[model samples]
Target chain A: MTGPISGPDELSKREQKALESLLFRLADDEFVLAERYTEWQIYAPTLESDLALANIAQDEFGHARLWYDLLGELGYTEPDLIWERPPEQWQHSTLVELSFPDGGWADTIVRGYLYDTAEQLRLEALADSSYLPLADRIEKVLLEERYHRQHAGNWLERLASGEGHDRVVAAVERLFPHAMSLFAPGPHEDNITEFGFRSESLQELRRAWLDTVIPTLDSLSVPAPEPAEVVRPDATGRDGSHTDDWFELYDAFTHTYTELENPTPVRLRGEGA
Target chain B: MIWEVFRQEKKGDYHKHCGNVHAPDREMALMFAEIQHARRMHANSLWVVPQAEIAEVDAEEASFGGTTDKAFRWAMTYNDIDASFAQEVADSEKEQEKAAKTREAQI
Candidate 1:
């Protein structure tokens, strides 16, 4: 029988690498997606929805900061880890990197619903992680994700019940495949699973996600994507292969950092600088 | 909907104002507040009040100012209590003692 899993300090070499990769994927995906969400800060259909999206974006950014801090403790400078990396070096899932088409409010809701469902699944699984620090962080993240899931579910219900329901359903159908690809096994997936960093495999977590989401989608009269079609993308994100949008996203996100004369600070500044 | 959340760090402690969260209703507000505030610490309990239900009284109102002097009600106004009140208390105690002795002798 397997022994009781220990905390971050007790992590094995393989486990540490796997955890680092997972953290990178989690943090980068949220950070980049938050920028996209922020684009709708003033453009949402309703003021309340706009505020909700912005709030969620801020929460995601905070989560990224937390993960980045973890990465720093594991021997990586935050700026070098986030800003200096090229687009191809990023490990964010393709679902988050996809450009939200100017397809109006329906498209936005569908995208939000898809991303939230996937995030909820990943976070729930991570909550049982062997690493104490990761498990604790995931628990905190899961709390916020509950609201995000509810908000997305509410919008999905509204769109499915109201006019243009068919259009929204079609949009979701088109996006579901990409959403499934969010769980594509990373380069260190085998090591992560074997080392007990996560209690479940990538495929196992994806299956669990589908079990919950497919039923909900069916209830909403939206068709779910087939499991076979939900495997790795033509450009696998786990292998550092990403779409063209990733380059644009990376450039835009790191523009300020790249333009700075001294991107990394060597000494302390004012009180909170 | 806006919820104002007050959180208590431990049992028997007073709940202090933490922050606000926007939700569709009270249930969602509580859920969001639990996540936003209490997730990081040892919060024992939370009190959530709807933003609309909160009543505010302006302390800056000019009409509510006190018009009369009520200085006599304040202890600070009766200065030199050791000199004035102490003698009065001693005299009163002596009178009470004399009355008690006369009553005892009559009995």
Candidate 2:
């Protein structure tokens, strides 16, 4: 609220908390969704789909790194932010943490469709954020998100028709509730907007998401539930609360890193190479 | 339909022709291209074009890099000038020498 807080060092204690909330939501969503997407890698319906999902997963992981790097500017190491962070402290939505059903190709399509649409809206809202670093990073994330949305939308249309109809519907019905968590406000949401971190309210983003998703699903001949008909999960996921699947996933992913005991962060690119 | 794939390893880089993939449409072609050409290789972007649409001028049809000697166009042709005095001219001569070696090797 007090002018453009350009750097993390300039932030007051409360402003820092607000920024962390936003960054964690952005980073964890991308990281967890990417992990789920990787589950479909070799198991995707076809070889091409496998590659497409793998590429999408990589794109998301890269996006996550971008946000996590921003968090690193606040003095948190990679292990503190991710590897050694407690499972419940991860702020990713339950939708991403939910495991795909056995051989459920339809699950990946519908999940990507719902998530990418919301992601697009969310990023568009963040494009003009007063927080300079946050705004600066939007373009890179948005460019890659375009391909992801296109990939998901293409599959969504094809899979929503003919013999695949029932499965797509089933997946949507199962995942839609958790997708609601995409806009669930964290404890610092008020500070986030008050500090000009994002222009759109979570309620506004949620409405925009619903308006976009429901109509798209309806056009695909998949009946979307009324917002009133859906039940929100007990865990908001924005407040560091999560589903059991999140705990299991956290354990699985961090196991190797933990067992190693020495967490010398692995660097794939940039100056670290 | 067959589509030729081009892979760009980084932003602002030229896309080099990689290989072709069997696909029914442009979308599917791109999907297949990512796997076929970009799976193991690094890619910032990929382009897929219909094989039939790409114009070609091979050695058997119209000679590539020209059949007749165009020695005057090469940087090495001007041997009177000391190209080493200028880094750019020296680099150009080195590139031309490599190209000449490649041409001779082909023959």
- Taking chain A by itself, what TM-score does each prediction score? 0.89, 0.97
lDDT at A239 for candidate 2? Answer: 80
Off by over 4 Å in 2: B1-17, B22-24, B31-107
Write down the C-alpha DockQ for each prediction: 0.08, 0.18
Per-residue lDDT tens digits of candidate 2, residues A1-273?
Answer: 568778987899998999899999999999999988888766777666777788889989999999999999999988898898888888988888888889888998888888999999999988888778999999988988888888888778877866889999999999999999888888899999898889899999999999888899999999899998898888768787888888888888898998899568678896676
**Which lDDT tens digits does candidate 1 get at residues A48-142?**
56777778888888888778777877878766777777678888777777777775677777777877877877777677776667777887777
Prediction RMSDs, each to the true structure? 6.3, 13.3
Prediction-by-prediction clash tally = 0, 1
Error of 1 at B66 (Å): 22
Looking at model 2, residue A166 earns an lDDT score of 95
